[model samples]
Target: MQMASTPTTGDRFRQLIRSLTGISLPPSKVQMIDQRLRRRVVEYGLPDTEAYLEKLLAGELPQDELPRVIDLITTNTTSFFRESEHFDFLTGHILPDRLAKARAEGRKRFKLWSAASSEGAEAFTAAMVLEEARRKGAGFDYAILGTDISARMLERATAAIYADEQLTTVPRDLVTRYFLRADDPSMAGKARIVPELRARTRFRHLNLMDKSYAVDRDVDVIFLRNVLIYFDATDKEQVVDRLAGHIAKGGYLLVGHAESMIVRHPLLRQVKPTIFQKC
Candidate 1:
């Protein structure tokens, strides 16, 4: 009789990543994963990605190392207002309607969640636009929550610091209005979200795979863009359904343009190609 052979380090690594984050690692991602984890392999003096995975899966490393591993493996690509049109709809359609309803209902607070916020850019972008509305006498207050699987990203998000290049997509006036340059000589090119806007925004570490999020179920809008592309069909569906549950009735869910065709949940109705409204 033949003995059963153990799965390769890459196979177990991929499975664990999917189980933890619902992110699929296709064959095409093999090179990318190895590339991303290369630093960790060297840092631990491991022979290769396989060795690093063995240590990680066996819990042989520090208690805190697993989170750091997840951070390195997960992709976090974002920019301020990467999809400008989303912000346009946000300020033009959603805000007006939500604000009007708020005024009529005697409510002052509005909430927006960046479901996969990376380094706080999207959340801060929303903050900038919402703050502008308040300045124009929209007369409503808002709080923004940014959640990511990467603690490294969340820490940077909480810091609210951004490089100058990251502000290119942000309009000049808004940049001046919302950011303050770092005084530290070592951080010259970086700027941070001003106190007022930073005060209204917060970041937390969250895995969308969790059965329930520790977020407000009455959230007004959720920007769950870009991140779903990493998930498989089943995982993607589960994530959307879970996200939809957190949205208040009549609130909105925005996905990436590439993911527009993928949003098909019973609780959500497509009002636009990439925009869905909760029923």
Candidate 2:
């Protein structure tokens, strides 16, 4: 004789999620939603996920709960140089060419933004590569800005620490040069990014769903990889168009290889499958 829960609760949750972050959570994601919110349910001593959802949708939960829920729900899969091709392009074409143009114009800094930066890996990776370029006498200064919506991820990024396993993808030479072994015994398995690299990399909280970003209008490169697949068609286009507005004319935008087809905004022209240039 147990009663079933109201279906409107789940529907409302989906609607609110999309409104807050522009991520479309489909019905197939019920299990994922429950799994992610399970700890919150337990924390609130709810009977089950249905009660938790009802409370959340009914505005019965604390005001601060939604942000925590978002931090849990949003996927944050990033790494140092996750896509090596982009970095290769940076060194081989983007950086050098931009440096030449800057030198000709008497400009001095190269600005790169990791639009979906998760835990500082992408920003620090760019810093490492750019530092190496500087060491080789590239004669240009550079800075990297990493932005993500998750406060938890931004905190970790600002810490600039990564566990040993999290660094396997990084080459040994680069690791030796760019990361320092953690001094604390409790942090034995982790290494922190070197000050020289961390100095030029910064992270901030940003939601791509916002009407405008607080980022620079003339960034030389933007890595908007692996994040567009979660949005529906309309959101995808809007996000791409907004991001394109931040690119310096003739600067490049790189998306995940899987998301290459989504960057068809008229302000950008496809140069490579996953690379676009601002026109």
Candidate 3:
């Protein structure tokens, strides 16, 4: 019998990534993949990238290894109030408008979803804004749900702890009001989001490429920011369509400022550069 031909390193990596995350890694990103996975390869005692890919592709690796690979590959760069304009719009226009409409309808609760919430910064920042609004006399209750594909990211998000530099964009007064300094000397320069804010937020594992989303249908606003850049056009359209189904009529959907859509959906209208409203 003839021996089977071995797959090339590039082909194996491409197939693994596409099968797991529905993301296509361009040739330019091969170096980035190597950089990210080098440590994992060592940790697993694999001799090189080829050995790591072989174990992963052959299904001989531990069950948890795949999740770790996904976690390592997924980007989790975020900061408190990273895009200040989105939060400003949320507090100044969207929340107030939604509050008035909800009050008129005799509803007292508002829901926000941080669909790609990594490390919880976006969700916690949103909680701070809502709490501040309440202090300014907005008469409505609010809750936030943060979701991500990486369990590792979700773990950090649930912890709600951050280094001082991660919060420079936040106003001093809000930081004083919403965050507590870490007590341990070894943890100096770190702060924890106060329990009150954490109480209004929750984190869960979510993959945008999944066939169906398991979230509430009456969400008032969704911050799906800085995530679509990893997806191709088809995945982007599918995700937008599916998310639109979960949004209440007249609700808002916020994407990254750098992202734009060539084809507009009928139910979603671009109200701002990166902000869409449901019809």
Candidate 3 lDDT tens digits, 88-171? 999999998888888888888999999999899999999999999999998889999999999999999999989999889899
TM-score of candidate 3 relative to the true fold = 0.95
A best-first ranking of the candidates according to their lDDT comes to: 1, 2, 3
- Candidate numbers sorted by TM-score from highest down: 2, 1, 3
lDDT of 1 by residue, 135-218 (tens): 998878899999999999999999888889999999999999999986789679989899999999999989999988989888
TM-score of each: 0.95, 0.96, 0.95
Of candidate 2, the 10-residue stretch with the lowest lDDT total is 4-13
What tens digits encode model 2's per-residue C-alpha lDDT throughout 134-197?
Answer: 9988888898999998999999999998999999999899999988995789789999998888
Query: What value does the lDDT take at residue 138 in candidate 1?
Result: 83
The 10 consecutive residues of candidate 3 with the worst lDDT sum are: 256-265
